[model samples]
Target: MSNMVKIAMTSDLSPGTGTTIEMEDQSIALFNVEGNFYAIADTCTHRGGSLGEGRLNGDIVTCPKHGAHFNVKTGEVTFPPARFGVKTFPVTIEGDDVLITLD
Candidate 1:
């Protein structure tokens, strides 16, 4: 089973940007890509870089520490210094709330 946790409101995040969300068990990178939202594990697979602090271009986020690139929509490594992909979470917008599912 999965639990949906409300992280922010739709109005809180702007398009073409990202933010870090700290939960009890994990850190998440939440991105707003042209109005659609995506959530991924905040840590870069290469050197524990913060993906939330990375640069967002289109749907790809570049790791701030080492330039590893990840697809925000799927959490797949697009370009690498990091061979492993990060984990992805499902995001939903209900009314004005932005929620991510944790399993």
Candidate 2:
């Protein structure tokens, strides 16, 4: 099993916003929609844009590079110039810390 690594404090993220965490060999994007938190691959499937730097409207993220939209919670492609979906990661909250388990 993969170990869960703490990436950021819960206070560090806000509703309708996103952040990036680079761990070992992975780049993860974290999103807070209201009080719920979700995570996904930070790289946009549609041309490698930084999804963490993308715009967030609800749980949908518009890729900064090419306007591809993805669901942060599901990593599903909602609108895209590219057909594939990025990977989604599981997130958990421990006190004020946000943790991710990557495999």
Candidate 3:
């Protein structure tokens, strides 16, 4: 078992929505997709676009800056502009709190 951090409450995030939170000086983006939660690096790999501000279409999120697409579930690059994929963290939901594992 690794160290985990509580990022948000279940009530704070609705389905198909996302929020940004700070973790170890880095911004992490948390998304709620049909009751399941996902977390990834908030900045886009291409030009440092904020993934939290990007548009969410199903499990994929399009970067608002360079139009790059990433899967919230896997943090894989689905579209161009970014040749790399973002880092994904494991998420856990306890009661109404949402937790993310960084280790």
Candidate 4:
């Protein structure tokens, strides 16, 4: 396994919001639920939309383009037209920093 990268501070992300970070030529989306952090592919599985720009409701994130919903915690597709699931990264919180492992 590779080392986890410190993408952002835990305080950097607010609840029900997400931030985008670029790593290894891939865009990853980091979300904050209360104090917990979740990371997922920034690209939506359907229509190539940006997941970071989507809205978050509980653990589900709805794609801005086509209304595709995904569970940020598990990367599961909750609604269509997103039949495929996006990638999710492992996230850890160290003090005020949020760390994630990239593919």
- The lDDT per prediction is 0.96, 0.89, 0.92, 0.89
Per-residue C-alpha lDDT of model 3 across residues 3-50, encoded as one tens digit per residue: 798999999988999878988787999999998999999999999999
Write down the lDDT that model 4 would get.
0.89
> Any runs in candidate 1 off by more than 4 Å, and if so which?
none
Positional deviation of residue 78's Cα in model 4 after best superposition, in angstroms: 0.3
lDDT by residue (26-52, candidate 2, tens digit) is 888989889788889999877899999
Indicate which candidate wins on lDDT: 1
**For model 4, what is the error of residue 38's alpha carbon versus the real structure, in angstroms, after optimal superposition?**
0.1
lDDT of 1 at 69: 100
TM-score of each: 0.97, 0.95, 0.96, 0.95
20 Cα displacement, candidate 2 (Å): 1.4
Q: Considering summed lDDT, which 10 consecutive residues are worst modelled in model 2?
A: 80-89
TM-score, candidate 4, is 0.95
83: Cα error in model 3, Å: 0.7
Candidate 2 residues lying further than 4 Å off, grouped into runs, are: none
Local lDDT at 35 for model 2? 78
lDDT of 1 by residue, 1-103 (tens): 8898999899988999999999758999999999999999999999999999999999999999999999999999999899999999999999999999999
